[model samples]
Target: MLRDIDPMGDQASIIGGVIEFIKEVQQVLQSLESKKQRKSLSPSPSPSTPKSLHLPAKPNPMGEVGACFNSSLADVEARISGSNVLLKIVCQQIPGQILKIVAVLEKFSFDVLHLNISRMEETVLYSFVIKIGLECQLSLEELATEVQQSFFSEPVFLNEI
Candidate 1:
């Protein structure tokens, strides 16, 4: 899970990971579609029929901020210079994701000195310049591993900077 897409690593591996993720998503969509089709085909239902589990759509609380979407999963790159760590993270533009990252940094005793966020159609790129705390004991590799595993259930690509 701590795999890094280093420049020196095989390019095929990265592509393979992306392809695998896409296939899984497609499968889930197809399953949902099939269920919808079956429900529509039945014009009337008896009392014994089980109620559909689908819930009514609700308005997005984030409004404009929640409209963005991304075609790919998350990617992160880490570079260390002296006591400072430079991080470049690209992921879906979801609310509270940045807070999760910040929480991890706090747990590791890293202080964010600067942050730059760029938003496109469906993705966000976060560039962070942070200072390593004097009491921090983890190495750069260990920090990368921790970040890689922080994302809830999505795969993360960690690249070397």
Candidate 2:
């Protein structure tokens, strides 16, 4: 006899977490490969053709760092005003991801005021507005850098797209 499946139970949650972890691992590996390719030259030996006869290969428009955020993956943003800080992170479902983010926030002296978590398919979106007491002393730039460094393995540059 076939048993009924419950999507809200522990077993289902464990499987989903495993799938998310695997996806993140694959993303990191692909990023490493792209970096290596950008750093190394073509392995083929030099051709005998005259320099005038051969055309130079076009460079990769994306360059060495490549795309930092994939639309299908994740995006992180931080907004600051006085002692109020708002952080928005939209990402694929990752195991213990929210806890990790919260831990980092605590280290930076930001107290979580409110948190909203919404799920779409396998993605989890987190919206947090935090408050820092007068005693908390960290500039916005420093806070932003710390957030990226703790949450991301790669160096992230903010660009308006």
Candidate 3:
């Protein structure tokens, strides 16, 4: 329903404004209706996007040179099987600390699976999930202690959780 009926005033301007307003309202209502229709069509929750399960791409040092190499050569020194270790550490708010942590893990012969880093206020939180063979030379406790000692310092707290 349109209101503000004008008799002597500029009818064209008032009518134009009303038309624009109606168009906007119609667009909004159409969007809402479409959303409702979609929801009704999919009463059950849609399956989660497969993209969520994808792990982040790790940096490959060998680059294109290794790409052309034999596939069997890549599997020669593989130690870890299907098991992995998840490590979470909180450290001082600084730069290059994560790189150091990764270097330590590599030094200990642990293959990093997934790593996530976040900052909570003044502290930096790091989560590293690693994979190691059942015959891994270093024990989990030993590795955790070594990592903690390597990264621990004043204003930095390292913990594996």
Candidate 4:
């Protein structure tokens, strides 16, 4: 004899499982949508601002630096002297945290020349190339030290975005 199945118990189990699955899907969808929104909201440079801007030249440490009456010339020379420094960093995927990295660069007087980001399964990797001008007093070592001390000190989560 086949025992009759309890319809109420079976129905309740199915309904409960469906509800749980729906909640999980909602959470994952929300996370992905938030990430998209954060990326879209990032501020882009204005058209008026040139792709590369230069700082004034300074004394070469061993020789006197010549002055140029034209500000454009001075700007161009400064940029020519200050090439970009490339760095790679890996961190937990987080939204709105790029600003913190930018802040660190600004603190060290490094101009952000270019930035590229890649997202892996569990990590967000940043590749940044920056230029430091002669006007900036900090050396490469000092800048790197400061950035490491400030930005990489703690693990960052994506809760802010």
Candidate 5:
């Protein structure tokens, strides 16, 4: 249901703001914990003060979430296997994107042998196995270039598989 909401709209902005706030809070908490540790190390704590009074430091999940948000989702990898070409792609979910991909494959005259699509949160991964007919004469490098250009607008990581 959350995916139904546009990421560029008000709800997305609100979520972004919340994530920013959580990051700030996590930073402050980490700094306070470090300062507490330093103070405890320098001055001798009184015997009456229980050593276990301070809570254990918890891992910061916000930092990991922020990193995930900041990183690019688009990626493309291709490999040759006998008469078939294996292609793996990761791109942000968008309307009409799948149709566009199918169109691109058609444009290059690739016969789809097998296709698998998986959606994870805001991104989608597409794994395609295709056969290049004798009519299609594009080289692997050229195919990579065309797919990189046609697949998504974001920076894509293209690698050989």
Candidate 6:
């Protein structure tokens, strides 16, 4: 199995590179946060005196905040009811990731009831209904967490029941 290879030679190097990349990303996030705090400490340069300079600025029609780009994974949703769990995932159009999700379910011993998939442009949406046996002995939270970690994205649950 890929997870079972000894982490000493080539695998070690790859793991090290990933760790270094994560550290770099964390540092960049921290730096951005510090810059944001610094900018919040001071007011912007005021315009020259005008007839009604003291009046407050008008609200923007668009929004109060600027636009931001998020490169994170698409959304994943899950819910459990009476020994059954349903998962809805929006992911990149990657076949391997979908397979990986199935593997995760198989690994955890869940019986899949239904698998539905749809695509729009570059994204794929998946809906899965799975049945969990009492013998599985895993809580809903644990199961949801496992799915999230396995997919490397947060899974939103709809009314945890």
Candidate 4 whole-model C-alpha lDDT, 0 to 1: 0.49
lDDT per residue as tens, model 3, 46-102 = 233111111222324533111111010010011222366656554445555666667
**What TM-score would each prediction reach against the true structure?**
0.49, 0.45, 0.41, 0.40, 0.48, 0.46
Best by TM-score: 1
Model 5 lDDT at residue 118:
62
| C-alpha lDDT score of every prediction, in listed order | 0.58, 0.53, 0.47, 0.49, 0.55, 0.53
Model 3 lDDT-worst window of ten: 67-76
Off by over 4 Å in 4: 1-82, 152-161
lDDT tens readout by residue for model 6, 1-161:
42356545577677885685565455444434543564487554332311111122222363321111112343444555445676766545654666667767777788889886766556666678898755677554455445545555333233421
| Candidate 2 C-alpha lDDT tens digits along 21-58 | 56655544554454346437444323332111112222
CA lDDT, candidate 2, residue 14: 67
| lDDT tens readout by residue for model 1, 5-118 | 466557777677677556545544444454457558755444343233322222244321111111123455566655578776666676667777877888999999988776
Q: Sort by TM-score, best first: what order?
A: 1, 5, 6, 2, 3, 4
lDDT of 5 by residue, 7-99 (tens): 556776768856855654554344345445656776744534322221222323432110011112234555676668766666567666666
lDDT (10s digit) by residue, model 4, range 1-161: 11144444666676775685565455444445544564487654443432332224446564433221111101111112335665544445545567766777776677888776656565555666678756778644444444444333343446642
Local lDDT at 9 for model 1: 51
Q: For candidate 2, what is the lDDT?
A: 0.53
Clashing pairs in 3: 80-133
Q: How many Å off is the CA of 86 in candidate 2?
A: 1.3
Best by lDDT: 1
Q: Residue 43's C-alpha lDDT in candidate 5? A: 70
Better of 3 and 5 by lDDT: 5
